[model samples]
Target: MLSIMFYIAITAEAMTAALAAGRRNMDWFGVCLIACVTALGGGTTRDMFLAHYPLYWVANPYVLLLVCGAALLTVAIARLVDRLRWPFLLLDALGLVVFTIVGCNIGMEAGVHPIIVIVAGMVTGIVGGILRDVLCNDIPLVFQGELYATVSIVTGVVYYLGLLAGLPADIVVLIALAVGFPLRVAALVFKWEMPRFVFDREMRK
Candidate 1:
């Protein structure tokens, strides 16, 4: 079940990234590149941090094909996708939580410290979007006071604690999703954001 959800989340991420590439007027190759990065970059980053051998996509190279296929499909139906913005947003939120859970699982398997587990989950959840935005020449959404990384951290904490309490892994995953997914959706609906620290003073040359 987790494997299925992971695939779906990556597909959704890829499609949305393809849309971003389209907006930038990128060619097919560029669209595929962006889609791959947005869908797989987070997990790749997490693997590198943990020094996990044979990265997820590296071990399962077909995921790259899946991402690129989803991206090209999105290009074919770009108009329809553009109109279903809310659905995509919700899928993206699901992806965030799922990625966090997966990352936490990897961190636990690595026998890392608890703090590192949460940080690993967060990096897995947000880094892909950060890479996407950077490649697209825009400010990363995670840095824009959105509730993205916070949601990942919360989900990771809940998941880790649930497992620590001896709950079944599947149940822990569902519980984390229940708590984190709603929090993110609520943040989006309520426009909840972190308070920004703006320093508008100009430096003296």
Candidate 2:
């Protein structure tokens, strides 16, 4: 899917930036490892789930080359990162939207209903990040950011609705990306959070 490809591209770029941010003393292998995990990990999980064989990167090994180039390109542009923070986040947001769309598409192809399509979409986006956080030994934002799964869920719903409406694929991708990306960004900027206490803690009589 075009959406998934774009998501991979965006993730590669963001991973390159992050590695550049942290790779001052890291060896070349370390750089490549980070780039690979960040870019390919999520899509790998998605494909594995759908039993989509050969995997996207394996079919097009140039994707690995593309990721490598991105990481190397970062070394030359490290100074620009200060101005590129917002861009990185936006790219990441795009990846999230696009990957979810691809996952839902796969679910539809598998004859899954709308609700499972939504869950599949969210799983595609979240699982890799969960793995990444575990590797990095940090708190996964999916657990901490109240908006995390909420954004994925909302975007999944949007993708399903767009499909049912028979919107052109391009339009659906654009609108979903536009809607989800900003909502996530706004959550970050405003520190907006879903209420955790909405569920009553009191034991019922």
Candidate 3:
């Protein structure tokens, strides 16, 4: 189940990256590069933090191939993506749920503290988008104007609680997805966002 969800998550992330590349009018190579970064960056960050050797994609070379193929396919269908905006949003939400669950599971299995486990989940869910945005010279969505990272933290907490309650692994994953996906989609659809804190420079005096 984790394997399947991981594949789906990477594919969805690649497609989202592809769309971002399209928006920038990037060529095929740029598209592939962005897609790879967006698809793998989060998991890579998580693995490094955990001191897990031979990163996920490096261990499973096929996963890299899969992401590359998905990116190329997305480029082929680039013209229709704008028209399918809602589906793209839904896919991105699904990716967030899957990655958060996977990351939390890894942290828990590694015997990390609960807070660290949840933070791992958030890093897994948001770092990819942050890397993509940075590469594109845009502010990462997790940092502003959205409830993006908040949803990841929510998913992580839900998953951690499920573990504390001794729920089965599959049930825990289902609960996280059920709760997180809708919350993320709602935020996207309703333009929900965390209130930004603005600092007044004159106050420094």
- Candidates sorted by TM-score, best first: 1, 3, 2
In candidate 1, what are the lDDT values of residues 53-87, reduced to their tens digit?
79999999999999999999999999999999999
Candidate 3 lDDT score relative to the true structure: 0.89
Tell me the TM-score of each prediction against the true structure: 0.97, 0.80, 0.93
Which of the two, 1 or 2, has more TM-score?
1
Which candidate gets the maximum lDDT versus the true structure?
A: 1
* lDDT tens per residue, model 2, 1-205: 5746674655555464345435445666666666666667776876787777788789989878877777767666666754677777766776777777777887787677778788778877767667655555666777874587788889989878987899987788778877888898888789898765445558654
lDDT: worst 10-residue window of model 1: 196-205
lDDT of each: 0.95, 0.72, 0.89
**Superposed Cα deviation of residue 35, candidate 3 (Å):** 0.4
- What is the lDDT, from 0 to 100, of the residue 46 in candidate 1? 96
> How many clashing residue pairs are found in candidate 3?
0
